[model samples]
Target chain A: MAKGPNVNWLPVKDDNRPVNLDLTKFHFPLPAITSILHRISGVLIFVGTAVLMWLLAESLSSEEGFQRVGEWLQSPIVKFIVWGILSGLLYHLIAGLRHLLMDAGIGETLEGGRRGAVLIIVFSVISILIAGVWVW
Target chain B: MVSRVSGATNLGRNGLHDWVLQRFSAIVLAIYTLGLLGWFAVNPDFSYGAWRGLFDATWMKIATLAAIIALCAHAWIGMWTIATDYLTSLALGKAATFVRLLFQAGCVILIFTYLVWGVQILWGL
Candidate 1:
């Protein structure tokens, strides 16, 4: 009988263990943090799309409709919403591009992924700032 | 049963397909977003007439439609993936899958409505 570690032939079973991970105490890596933020930004953009579609539909209806949207956008609250949505969009866009590049065999390594995450954060901040200035 | 296992594996394959389509749609959306933003940035005097004229071009209308479709596709896959990852039997038990399916259905309805609305707007009907 072969009694070596490499020679043991045991059937692997499905891991049905209960997950007890304490998310609050868990320390996520930078890349993981970026990934979670990407999901969140996606949700934000999803919700914001309704508001944008409404604005678009209204603006395209008539000249008065367009004026109404333009005036509404001038309000501080509306401007704030626009800024928030644009910020979410900008972050999501950058992170999404990172994911695409990863799929294309770029940033496939651990160090490369980390660098990409950092670049996404930096680019998103600058873009959001520009969007804020444009909206305000 | 072996058939059941194969069925589950097929679902996994479909997920891979969804992943590919999601990225493809994302690329389309990114291009459209950049172009639209650039147009707005250069045209400081954005009025109703300017907005109308921009969409008045056939190419612009087609591009906008394509972007709208891609946006819907991307959002559907994204939201579906999120729901599947977070909302599961381990989390919400029996209610989890039901809620996830409901949310997905709602997204589908919303996407369909947006597509119809987009077509109407683009064709000026």
Candidate 2:
């Protein structure tokens, strides 16, 4: 340890906080859970973006290519996958908007944060459902 | 030496710089997403001809290229944060740093590929 100059400080006490935490056992607050879901949706969007990119490319290749891409998307599994991606995207967008609001000092309080989280989840669910309808 | 000196990760270097980058990119990406959603709302049951025509426009092409670049920058910071948050020493023990580097490397490659492929798709003959 590096030596401190001038006045002497008191000795530090032993830290007893759990080092390896079991996340599932711990209860998280609404805002914390929303934050976690934001990350989760972000990661999901990351993978989905790649899939979307390919679809974009293939659809733009030719008229036949576009029709073929649409045909393959007729499968329920593919529709579900695309819906999942859209769901992730919708949730992520709403959550991200909340983050931007926080950045602008709009909803930085605890009460504000909780309300914001509820709003995020509610709006995201509504958007995701609408996306599901459109996709189907 | 610089990482040790500044206490910064080597991937994107500075925390504040990365924060600003992510914010700016986020705004661009958010607008692009909203724009696409609005287009879909307006163009229900849009045909291949309409879709191709939309992309064929110079302005839309420029907009897409800009969004692709923003996506790369935005995604890099997001993934880097995720890697550092979860793949740290507390979670992965001694090999966490190594694993993080590998993960970040993959993210960089994938993001860059997306940028190039997006350009190809946007402007390809």
Candidate 3:
């Protein structure tokens, strides 16, 4: 390792002049968008798992337990929550598959990543529609 | 690195496993979701015996079980990849590995619990 001072540890203001800091000039790229969405979907899955597990435990306890869960599903508010969870599951599944594909060297190129993002959107919409039908 | 032609397919390296598993799970979940919707549409009462009868069918039992298993496996693989990729520090990486092990174990327990429940319903246990 170099014995010189670490440039990365320096404050941004020390490294660059205030006049040069033009935030408006910067724009988010496609890859950044996709990456952000991936993290979002991951969080969604984490939250959804908690809710789904509760439903599973309740439904399996007894016949009345099953009925209670079934009744919750019938309510519009509960249905909305279920639909939201399903949507999260659906998007996370698709985006995750994309990341796996990328890791396997499938979508490493710029064009490939763009296409993968498009595919994610398409899959998400289709799954959401299915959830809508199931819920409503 | 020299690429040799051993010809034994590297399914994991080529992402075939991920692709196939993901789509396979998706298909299972799709069918399961649709069937559950139908159950609600046709028999909304959701009585004790009615719920039992639904899961008692050979196809429903198999399908639901399969869906649960596939969903868990698919989610496990996905989460493991994310945790490994992001947590860069060696210590954090090891922590993530431990977490992944817990995740896989938990998923197995989940599937086992569901299977036991389903069997008890079918076999009067």
Candidate 4:
């Protein structure tokens, strides 16, 4: 919270005129931030899918290939990228669950939704940290 | 409001259909992910032999195939939703529709390739 971006994405006055609408000057609410983060994590995992597919295909190709994959996991940079993708997957999974819950009529209120968003942040950080440990 | 101009191009030509498919595919994907995590936990130091054995099973192959299909469907809907949400006339001006369709066509081809490639990888196992 020390240094934050400065922008209001879609601020409008009572008359529906633009208040700021500057991308950099956006003031993000917790809910909005969480929602955007969900979108971001989904896109990240989507882009990383090709790498994942390649890894799967290679690892299953032969004994030598499988051993190579295991060894690749030992590399620090490979481990980092794996962890990043895992983090994105886990975040998307968690946020997607929240969306499902909302669709099912749970936490549908403004206040309840805020609480859900807060819970998502807490859970995602803890889960991502745990996944990091597991990956490394 | 979300745009409906591109609705006809959506999967099944129905928002509810896309919505249901998205959620269904999501559940399948989540289950598949959790299943992998469970396998990892059980294997601890899973060797190449053990890993191959896991996928070599008929059940596991079926599960993997199902997961890949769900992944493609889930991704298609998600990408389409993102495009319609942002790649619009309101944001991208007059050429938005053209640009969006081009982007979407790319997505479709990529997803289809993933689907075919995934099936090949799995069944060839």
lDDT of each: 0.82, 0.84, 0.63, 0.85
lDDT of 1 by residue, B1-125 (tens): 32232234221257678777887899899999999899989998688888988888999999999999998888887877777777655456657656777777787788888889888888954
Candidate 3, chain A: TM-score?
0.79
Which 10 successive residues of model 2 chain A have the least lDDT summed? A2-11
lDDT tens digits, residue span A49-123, model 3: 557767865776687788889889889998998888878767766776677677679988989988888888888
DockQ of predictions, in order shown: 0.44, 0.45, 0.11, 0.38
Model 3's DockQ score: 0.11
User: Taking the tens digit of each residue's C-alpha lDDT, what string does model 2 give over A1-136?
Assistant: 4323221111343444334356776789999989999999999998899999999999899999899889978889989999999999889889998899899999899899999999998999899999999988
lDDT of 1 by residue, A1-136 (tens): 3222221112343434443444666789989999999999999988898888888889988999999998998999999998999999999999998888898999899899899989998999999999999998
Segments in model 2 whose C-alpha atoms lie over 4 Å from true places:
A1-21, B1-13
Superposed by TM-score, candidate 2 places the C-alpha of residue B69 at a distance from the truth, in angstroms, of: 0.5
Judging by lDDT against the true structure, name the best candidate.
Answer: 4
Q: How well is candidate 1 docked (DockQ)?
A: 0.44
Superposition error at A90 for model 4 (Å): 0.3
> Model 2 — TM-score against the truth?
0.89
Residue A42 of candidate 4: its Cα lDDT? 84
- A5 in model 3: Cα distance from truth in Å? 13
| Cα error, candidate 4, residue B121 (Å) | 0.9
Candidate 4 C-alpha lDDT tens digits along A1-136: 2322232233442343334544567788899999998888888898888889988999999999998888999999999998999999988999999999999999999998999999999999999999899988
Model 3: CA > 4 A from native = A1-43, A46-50, A53-57, A60-63, A70-81, A93-136, B1-23, B37-50, B90-125
